[model samples]
Target: MKINFKNYIASIFITVLMVSIFSSCTETKEEVTLLFVGSFTDKKTGEGIHVYEFDTETGKSTLKHTIDSITNTSFQRLSPNGEYLYSVVDSQKKYNGKVAAFKVDVPNKKIDLLNIQDCGGLNPAHLAIDSSGNYLVNSNYSDGSLSLFKINNDGSLSENSQVLQFKDSSIIKSRQRASHMHSANFSPDNNYVFAHDLGADKIRGFELVKKQGKVSLENPKEIKTKPGSGPRHFAFHPNGRFGYLVNELSGKIDAYTYSNGNLGFIEDYLTYQQKQHIYRTADIHISPDGKFLYASNRGPEEDTIVIFSVDENSGKLQLVGHQSTYGEHPRNFGIDPSGNFLLVANMYTNTIVVFKRDIVSGKLTKLPFDISVKNPSSIQMKTY
Candidate 1:
C-alpha cells in the first residue's frame, strides 16, 4: 500500500468543504425584525391613524409614518404571517361601515393602504386571522356582532360568509345594557375565536370552518362572567389549558380552563388591588413562557400593573406583585418576542413605557425607555 500524504490532505479538505456546505444550508433563519404598530385618530382634529416602528432590542420606537382617511383608527391587527396590517375605523360608507387593510413593507418599515371592506356593522374594534389565515374575524363593538371575511393574498378583505350578533343579558343589565363586543382574540389553534362583549357580559366562542379558500364560523358557545364584570381583553395560556379575561368595569381578571377552544368554569377570578384602593383593569397578557400573567390597571389618574404566577398543572393564578407603569391609562401593551421586555401603551398620557421582567418572579420594573405617540391605543410586534 502506497501512503500519499498529499492525497490525504486533499481528502480532508473535501470533507471539510462538504460539511461547511451542509451546515450553511441547514442553518435556521434569523427571526424577522419586530415591528410595533399603534393607531391614533384624534377626535377634535379629524386626524388619521398613526403607525410607529420600534427596535425590539433597544426598546426604541419612532413614528415611522401615518395613513390618512381613517376617521377613527382604534385597533390594528397584523396578519399571522406579519406581511399585512389591518385596521378598523369609523366609516359612513354605503353598506360596509369601516375596515381597511394596509400592505406592510417589512424592509422600509412603512405602511400603505390596500383596500377597505364593509364591516357589515358599526364600530369595528377587533380583527383576527383564522388559523389558516384565509379569513379575518371582525368584532363590532357597537352592534355586538362578529363578522368573518375571506382574506386575499394581497391583503384585501372580502365579505364574510357569515355574521353573528350576540344579544344575551348575562346576569347584569346596567353594564350589559344591550350588547357590545369589546375585543376578539384567537386561541393557539386558531380554530376558535373568542369575542369579549362588555355589554353582553359574556365571552362568545365561535369555531372556524374551512372549505378550500374560504372560511366561516360554527359551533357557537358562550361563557358567562359575573354580573357587571364587563369583560374586555382576553388571553389564552401557552399550553392551551387556561384562559384569562380582563373585566373593564369591575377591574377583575377571570381565569378559566379551555378545552377545544371552549372555556370551562372560572378556576380563580381575582381583582387587582393596590394598597386599599381597587383599580380598574385595562389590558391583560400572559407571559410567553406560560409562567406569569400581567394585567394593566388604570385608576383614572393613577395606574399600576399586577402580575400573577400561573400554576402549570391546574392553570390557576397566584398573585405575584404589582408595579407602577409611570404613565396613565395603559390601554395596551406588547410583550417582546424574547419575553424580556413589555412596552405599555398609555393613551391619556401619550407614551409607550418599557419594562424589564424579573425572570424568576415575573414582576415588571419600569425601564428608562418610553416611545411617544399621540393617542396610542393598541401595540403589536412583528419579528421578521
Candidate 2:
C-alpha cells in the first residue's frame, strides 16, 4: 500500500479521541456532598449561611458560597429530599424572629430564597422538617413557644399554623424562671414531634394529628427531668427505639426508650468526666450505624466531644472516651452520611474542625483541616 503520512497522523488522532470518549463514558461519576453551616452574625449582615464542598474520602472541605442577605441564621435543617434548607433567623432583639426557606443549587453554588415567614415567636433557636416534607416546627427560646408550619408544595413555609406557648418554670430561677423552648425534633417515624424546654426542664411530645388532609400537633406528652437539667437537644437512634437528651445546664445525657409517642427514662450519663460548675452541653448525635453517640460540651471549664458506645440490645451508652475539639466552644457537630468523618463547629474559635471517624472502633482522630466560619451554630450535611 502507498504510505501517506498525513492520513496516518489523522488516523492516530481519531483512535486516541475514540478511546478517550469511551473511557469518559464508562467511568463512574463522583457524588457531590455539601456541608451547610449556619452562623450568628450582626444585625442583617455578614455570612449567614456557608456552603462547603466536602470531600468524603479526604475529610477536607472547601468553601463554595456564602449567603449574606439572611442574617443571624443560628440554626438550620435540610429537607428530606435535600432540595431545600430551612433556617431560623435569631436577631439581636428578643422579639420577632423569622424562619426562611431556600432552594439549594449545589452545582451552581447558589441558594435562592424561597420565602420568609414569621416564626410566631421570638428568638427561634432550632427548627425541624418532617420526613413527609409537609410540615415544619420551630422552637422559640425567648418567647417559650413552639410554632408549627405547613410547608407549601414549593418548599416555602406557610404562616405558622399553630403556636404553643409554655409558661412553666423550673427551680433554676436565673435560667429557668420562664419557659425557654430551645430545640425541636421529629420522631424518626414522623409520628410525633418533641420540643426541648430548657427552662421548664422537660421534653414535651406532641402527636402529629392529620385531620382532613392537614397536619397539626396535638395530645401533648411530657417527660420531666431534673429541675436544673435544662433539656436542650434531643437525638434519636437510627433504630428509633432509643433516644438521648443533652441537658445544657447539668451536662448530662439522659437515655430513654422511645415507644408510641412516649420517652421512658433508661439511665443518665454525665457528659463531663469531672463535674464543672459552669458548663453547657450543646448538641447530641448518633452515628448512622447506631454504634456510637457523640455529645458536645461548651464551657468556661470544658470543650470536648464526649464519645459513647451504644449497646444495641439494651439501648444504653458506655463511655468510649473524649476527644478535645481542638477549638473553643464546640457548639454543634455533624457526622457525614457514610459515618466516616465528624465535623465540629467551634463557635468561639470561629473554626470548623474535621475528625476522621473509625467505623469499627467508633473513635475519632482529629484531622489537620480547619475551616474558618464566624460564630457557626449549626452543621448539616447532604449528598447529591
Please identify model 2 stretches exceeding 4 Å from their true place: 1-28
Q: What is the per-residue lDDT of model 1 for residues 109-185, given as tens digits with 9 covering 90 to 100?
A: 77788888778787777787765667788888777788878888788887666778877655555556789887887
Least well predicted 10-residue stretch by lDDT in candidate 2: 87-96
Per-candidate TM equals 0.85, 0.92
C-alpha lDDT of all candidate models, in order: 0.76, 0.91
Q: Give residue 45's error in model 2 in angstroms.
A: 1.6
Clashing pairs in 1: 32-383, 32-384, 33-384, 34-382, 96-118
Kindly give the number of clashing pairs for every candidate.
5, 0
lDDT of 2 by residue, 1-384 (tens): 898999999999999999999999999977999999999996667789999999998988988888976779989999999999999885545678999999999887657899999999988888888889989999999979999999999989999999999899999898999999999889988999999999999999899999998878999978899879999999999888999999999899999998888888999999996989876899999999999999999877889999999998899999999989998999899999899999999999999999999988889999999998889889999888
